[model samples]
Target: MSKKVIYGIFDDEEILLNSVKEVRSNGIVIKEVYSPFPIHGLDHVLGLKRTRLAIAAFIYGAIGCVTAIWLTYYIMILDWPMNIGGKPSFAYYLSMPAFVPVIFEMTVLFSAHLMVITYLFKCKLFPGQKSSSPDPRTTDDRFLIEIESDDEKKISSILNKTGVTEINVKEIS
Candidate 1:
């Protein structure tokens, strides 16, 4: 099923930000806003909830830390015990300082790479995926706002006052 949506195109971020606030204050629901770059505080004005990517990063880092510890312990203490620098290979604690760099690197590696993968999956963005933006200009110098509403004239009037460069109406599935 397809529904009618109003697209308000703006040239400036400040105008777009103020327009969003004004639209929401007037009880108009905005579906999405597309921009070329991140606009600070737009999320707050849009009333979006905080993301959980930080928690995911911490968990991924923990897994990497544990894996590094296990790998070092198994290789140095269990698999092949080698006496180096007068330190006994059988005791993990005796040579734990040498594994600190490996542990830190592994934690950082997992946190960085896994967080990127998690973000890509969450956004459904992958190789060969077509763009979902309503206007190609939004990826350039324009900002586009998507609002699903049956009343077109009222929205168009309000958006016109908010300084939209152009307004377009379309049916979206």
Candidate 2:
């Protein structure tokens, strides 16, 4: 069965929380929420699990570190083997100071780029993908609750009962 999202917009945080409670108490499933800024306790209100994006970023950063180390070592010590002055060419410990900048850069580069890519992939937000957002205003100054439902009448009733300021329906086809 295809699912669609019905959204309710609210201005007050208290009203938003109350609406969420009311809808959930009625056994309706909320798909997601959008807010202009992070709302205190909203994640708990929505029963959302913590994201693992940081963990993924850490792993990607570690991969970048290893890659940078291997590449630098291979190029500086093995491939060219240039001895500057009396310093040893393959001095891994002595050359560590020079490697610090490259290592740091690689770590940041990999973590940032990979995290963005992973987040987009996880949310199915690829290029040309059309996802339903209730209203553009919701991104600016309103709080939005997006719920999955098929019964329009029931959804409208819930929104009315919850004191929603505005509402919109979007089919995710």
Candidate 3:
């Protein structure tokens, strides 16, 4: 089934932000918003939930830390025990200082790489993927508010009062 969407275009970020708050206050649901650059406080105005990517990154880093510890201990202490700098061959704690750098690096590397990959997948973004922006101009200097509604007149009436520079409505299949 196809759905109808109203695209409210604005030339200024301030107006866009205020419009979002006002429109939502009028009991309208905004599907999404697009902009040229980051607009501080827009998320709060739009009532968007905070992202939990930081939690995912922390978990990934922990996995990397554990893997690094296991790899270093097995190679240096168990698999090929070597006495370095008078430290006991089998004493992991005795040479833990030497392993700190490796552990930290591994944790950072794992978290950064895995978080990026996960973000890409979450956004369905990759090389050669088709863009979904309703207006090409939004990438440069314009902002867009996408509202899905069945009553065109109702949505239009709301946006018209919100100082939108332009309004475009279309049906998506």
| Local distance difference test, candidate 1 | 0.94
- Clash totals for all models, in order? 0, 0, 0
Model 2 off-target regions past 4 Å?
1-6, 150-158, 167-173
Error of 1 at 19 (Å): 0.6
**Model 3 Cα lDDT, one tens digit per residue, 1-173:** 45789999999999999899888998989999999999999989998888888999999999999999999999998899986777766688977899999999999999999999999998899999998998999899999999998778877887788789999989977
Model number with the top TM-score? 1
Worst 10 residues of 2 by lDDT: 130-139
Q: Which pairs of residues collide in candidate 1? A: none
Query: In candidate 3, which residue pairs get closer than 3 Å at backbone N, Cα or C atoms, i.e. clash?
Result: none
How many angstroms is residue 97 displaced in model 3 relative to the true structure, after the best TM-score fit?
0.9
Off by over 4 Å in 3: 1-3, 85-88
How do the residues 44-130 of candidate 2 rate in per-residue lDDT, one tens digit apiece?
878888999999999999999898898888888878878778677876776778888998999899989999999999989988997
RMSD (Cα, Å) for all candidates, in order, is 1.8, 3.3, 1.9
| lDDT, residue 160, candidate 2 | 84
How would you order the candidates by lDDT, starting with the best?
Answer: 1, 3, 2
**lDDT tens digits, residues 1-173, model 1?**
45689999999999999999999999999999999999999999999999999999999999999999999999999999898878778688978999999999999999999999999999999999999998999889999999998888889999999899999999766
